[model samples]
Target: MTDQTDGGRRLSTQEAARVLGVKPATVYAYVSRGQLTSRRDPAGRGSSFDAAEVADLARRSRREAAAPAGGELSVRTALTLIEPDRYYLRGVDAVALASRYRYEEVAEWLWTGKLAPGAVFTAPPEALAAAGRAVAALPEHSGPIDRLRVAVAAAAVADPLRFDLSEEAVLGSARCLIPTLVGALPEKAAPSWPGDGRISRRLWSRLTAREPDPDALAVLDLALSLLVDHDLAASTLAVRVAASARAHPYAAVSAGLGALEGPLHGAAGRLAHRMLREVLEQGSAAPVVAEYLRAGRRVPGLGHRLYRAEDPRATALFARLEELPHAAPALTAAREVATTMARQRDLHPNVDLALAVLTVSSDMPPESGETIFAISRTAGWIAHALEEYQAPPLRMRPTGHYEGPTPPQPLP
Candidate 1:
């Protein structure tokens, strides 16, 4: 058994097969049957079972050589990698990766099978000009995300080649849309040398306001990388469902953004931001937090569905924030509030809370909070769309139960 500390390493089925003196196909069968545990590699290949877990499985199998009636098994479409507990991309901890790389680069890696490669740097002038028009068309009061949503949809429409979700078209759209969403015409492109190893981090910094103080942009880049994908989150599920209708990536992703815009999925950032604003405006983070507890309102960005301890992504962001030069009084206040709230209510900060503080600390425009989340999430949306396109069709159909006495007197 490998030590528990070998967190990211994996042995191939061929290698494990040699260890077990079995065929490689048999090893792969062990994985599909869940009799062996394995993980995806950086190249998207699922390497063979964990030595420790596989040993355990072998032990149990040997002990129970002939039994079949103890437990039931079922086939599942959740094979889409939607399980919250173990979901990841290329063995990179999704949450950990979010805090480890840049937003643009993360999207690129997930889509085109490369990490931090240079964007197809020469977007047609027409594309940029069309994006500018989309920008101009937005109401001045609309926030960055709203503008992005509109612009992306517009770009897809204007392209006329959008239905071509051929591998080439999908990849190109992803590359162009990534930058366009992060920054419009005037936003500076980060100084990433093509194929530069740190291009993802550099691009992340570019998305921040012109003068981000604590290097929150860097922290955000890492966070985005981790969060950029989750197997089939509700919004991602929406994208997949829409894709089952033969929707292209753009159409699918647009549907995803709509689902994300809902409160339960996309609006956590806004919730946290509003809570923090109330705390700052009222001169105390306590009463506001306490009232929420008293009212049973969900404390925005505290608990997470997958993480039980502190969310690793939140921990990573907070750790890097200590050295930020652009720290605000409210950011400090919010942290203290977070600490106090934790002790007082046993609640801890979640990703949204951390990001809310970051947005405030960055002096970003108010709407920028949701905008950033959506922007980071675009990668996930696109990824889910691609996955759906590759998957078997129409599995999302829901069955309806007959009710109300079989439609009553309709036959009369």
Candidate 2:
């Protein structure tokens, strides 16, 4: 094939692919991502790409090695951008949104491209009854998140039209889902939700036995919004992988919960919460911090993969904690623990620390942080499931190269 030049040296898709030492699809991906400049064919037959840009991209792609953990799998997502210190959810500043918006509002924005004004979400009475039965039927010692898992399963069973994958249908389910999940937690008294029935208000009633205060409730709200999503986390990936199998949205969220059961992901805050409680009870963080370090265990909630400095979410939550008079002891203990970690190990606290502090300050259940994380992440799981549903099914299958002993020849 003859190469074509339009003013500058331009290459057709095939020629550009050859120059870049990549496939035609990769060339298109580069063009779509704006890594390569392309224009319509002057002859109106095929597309033309800038040869110089193609060459430059080729050089850069060659120098870049595959990321160690991901096996060189490149996933293109427009949902979240994770930087060293901050992240954006669909181009909105996530930290700022956490402070300025309600959890449900942010969840709607994440699920749908546009935020709907005057949106209100209420759980269906029967679905709530189903979820409540599921939660109450569990063992008395069942954790908050366990109740949530059962509730999700029950909700899915109750929804007859859950197989529908249309945007309107999925969003409709999610609108009820948040409330149903929150309502499923065992109520401490009559009318478990005493406030305006916002998710934050309902969630507070579920997690704590004590009455709610505005300061504590504000912290929980911010915590939920901040934890709503991070790009391709382990749990989020699990959700996407499930959705790629064409699983219903509820099933996809269940998959996310399964992955989040691990300590490294969802339960990290529980560990931090325990340690913070120890500090508050002992009236000093020095011995607890020293013992944790001496055991050669990295302090949980002190570091994160995506931030070199302090986590922006943690910073925002910690700032809000300063205004609560009742949280003074817990806040001081958290501050001491953070200062000790930073001074001794040069590591900064992540959002888990702030979450633990919030739980302790509000006198919520010790496992409440994990529950908040799971609930907040449900929005992200649903959003990812929606995105995956639009793609070809089972697209996330991974092939493994043989590294074991060769098998015997087949008996013919």
Candidate 3:
């Protein structure tokens, strides 16, 4: 017995092959591929393998073979890398960037690969007017995302050079497009604070009728920064597909906005908001949370597929909110929900729960979080679009395997 074989006895090649249900050659192949670790005996015996690694790999292999499409297939991306519990944007710590930098800064970094301190984000007045008109033309019950889609379309029509897919031209278009989208949404009042012209404050005005608190404004900015890009999210993938076809930046972002409307993606924030509101109104989380569990319903904002530990983005935002007095109640409710879910199912809250808490605690509209998600994700979409434009056209097409009924005869 050795102390290093996952705290148990190591196995020789023959024994390991037996446990793995494979021949000795297969065991050596596993070692060659780095799937199993093997150590040589000090007394000149043959290589010994870690039993636990062999067992784990056997289980994983079976599960993967039985799984359907989209099972841990690696897609090469230089934009973002998602690790066990945290994500990096172009090799930068996203959580660190969110905490210290504004959304504008993060966007610049993602789109241009540099965070210029003196960089400016400005929208053309004519485009802003066009966005306003487009938003006003929508139905009264339309959500912010609907307005965003209309605004992008309008911007596309207004910009004659929108077809220029060059990087320089695309960067200019994206910078104008983001603020214009924010400006197009309904705002209760004009910028009242000193730096109210900033997109975060402008967006804050549009999201709520209340006076903008500095702390809340900071949280909103951080939220935007945190969400700017998340590898290849559903929305980002949609944007990339469009861009691969040489679609304009506006059209690419529109594709992303369309995917963002799906419930399992960007719109998850609204569902989470509803659940948290119920908890806040009832004065306790147990009853409402328990009812969802008993009914076999998925508890929104409770779990994430990519993160095994606490979501770093959620943690960063919650830590910021802890310093703000006004966010206490909402934070408390979020904690209760988190604790309850972990106790019951051992699941952790993801970025959605953090977003819900931000909106509810700060008294933003129910749809505010989704709006933030769309706007922030716009930066990511554009980054992906830029990347895709340089790739071979139509390279993402997958060949379909025919599983339908066989033909009776050949064109009789």
Candidate 4:
């Protein structure tokens, strides 16, 4: 039962329990745990919950229940910590670090505790040549990620010292492998000169034909720095698992790249890019957002489970994008999408949305954001692999809970 109250519709305890897919006792427990709020009934009935609040709680409950059992394993790490609205890298504010340093400097800091102010990563001639040949052999219809996977594999094969898991050796491989991956991509822009060794500049040439303004390049570099690590994301976990099995750094990174190909992970930004483009062509976000909802598709890049407020990475990127004249239209469209969605639910823009604005305004293809994520996250994957190398081999193996029928009777 529900009552239309001055504040909103109020669901009785029974109704709340039914909505939450739990018993009445669990509903009371939720109120006590502060997961839900309840108010005393006016006519001396039992507690009542706000209808919208119960619905939101129910949604979260369904999502949590859908996740695989025993999937929430926790491991101690000194890398990154995600809070409600902000995240940190080794106890330092990530946004502040990105704002103050280049991507190479930040990556160096993440790898070693020491900061290298003018750090630069350069690909070796042999490894770069091998990766380039491998990437060039792929079909013309292959995507950026396909090229990246092939490049990493070829780079691994080219490195004679790839099996040396010592800290110094692994770091050496990382420094070379990162640049090799960037250098392997076929350049979309005309080669004007021997480029500065900055990873962002080289990656920019591969992403679009248009020359980048200084601010645009700065934003791209910042995006790279900000994305360096996010504390045991799915791909990072994959890297760790591979590393736990004593896989070499290159193989560990390959594991991460494989996991990143999933749509729910690295490909999110591409979806957001397409949606923003649609909003631009349609002249408003309403119709585009409405069509998405009508078709039972999520309006991507709006919410993140780790954040209740704005995603800090998104906030930082959006701030930088506002100063770029070319980004104004895409930025406005992003804001419109967020605002329109906000009217229904309090979802905020995530980093993917900000990345979409960058990709859309810069005349890059939809897959550019994923490529950036893959390249930037290589640093983090290598860091995790290095950490895992120090732990006991095969430490990530977990016992599975068996739920099969009686084995003896199934022999037929």
Q: Which candidate wins on lDDT?
A: 4
Q: Quantify all predictions' global Cα lDDT against the true fold.
A: 0.62, 0.83, 0.83, 0.91
Clash-forming residue pairs, model 3: none
Comparing 1 with 4 on lDDT, the higher-scoring candidate is: 4
Worst 10 residues of 3 by lDDT: 65-74
* TM-score of every candidate: 0.70, 0.82, 0.80, 0.82
- Taking all chains together, the TM-score of candidate 4 against the true structure is 0.82
In candidate 3 the C-alpha lDDT for residue 47 amounts to 86
Query: Positional deviation of 385 in candidate 4, in angstroms?
Result: 0.7
Model 2, 37-151: lDDT tens digits are: 7788667868888777778876665444223244665555778999888999999999998798888889989988687664667999988999999888999998876888899
Better of 3 and 4 by TM-score: 4
Q: Write the per-residue lDDT of candidate 1 for residues 1-412, one digit (tens) a residue.
A: 2223356444666667655544566577667776787775655665645676655655554333233234321112222243334445655555554555456656766775567643332344566567768888777666555666676776676577778756677767776666665444234445433333242333444345454333654666665665676655777778778866768777777787788777788788777877877887888877887898899887787877775556666677677776675656556766766776678566667777777777666655455567666766777777666655543345445445567675556775
User: Model 4: per-residue lDDT, tens digit, 1-412?
Assistant: 7899889999999888777755576688678879999998768987889999999987765554344356776665778999998998889999999999999999998898779988889899999999999999999999988999999999999999999988899999999999999999999977576556789988999999988877998999999999999998999999999998999999999999999999889889999999999999999999999999999999999999999988999999999999999999999999999999999898999999999999999999999999999999999999888877754456576667889885767555
Q: Determine which window of 10 residues in candidate 1 has minimal summed lDDT.
A: 71-80
- Each candidate: how many clashes? 14, 0, 0, 0
